[model samples]
Target: MKYDGGAQNVLSEDYYNLVIDQSGNKTAQGVINVANDMTISNSASFLTSTNTIDVSEQQRWRNLNW
Candidate 1:
């Protein structure tokens, strides 16, 4: 997953529960997990490699007043 240029809020006082997971594979397999109030930005690459099996999971909330 890639986050461009933007503001992200993983946790807020009015919300609860946030989790993120990133995985990749080359000759071997690898994984990454982030929990609670995490933000990624600026063309970030979650899992990158030559033979990467790139994978990611994220959960969050946003308020839209319309």
Candidate 2:
């Protein structure tokens, strides 16, 4: 918090943006959003020489509730 009160409470992240103007105006934007969907991700890469390349990918998911 600083003495200058031009704009307060501002936050910006990788996929989202937020701003609060001096007149109590708020602006928000998000590039990515996921709602009511199960999210999963997997990736694979090769780590062999130019002559030989080996790539493998596997995924395992487990959900437990009590």
Best by TM-score: 1
Write down the lDDT of every candidate, Cα atoms only.
0.28, 0.21
Clashes by residue pair, model 2:
none
Top lDDT: which candidate number? 1
Model 1 lDDT tens row, 1-66: 222323332222222332222222112123233343433323332332333222234543221211
- Candidate 2's displacement at residue 60, Å, is 36
> Mind giving the per-residue lDDT tens digits that candidate 2 earns over 1-66?
111133232222221211121333222222222222211112211111223211122322211211
| Stretches of candidate 2 exceeding 4 Å from the true structure | 1-12, 15-21, 31-66
**TM-score, predicted candidate 2 vs. hidden true structure:** 0.15
Reference-based TM-score of each model: 0.23, 0.15
Least accurate 10 contiguous residues by lDDT in model 1: 19-28
How well does candidate 1 score on lDDT at residue 64?
A: 23
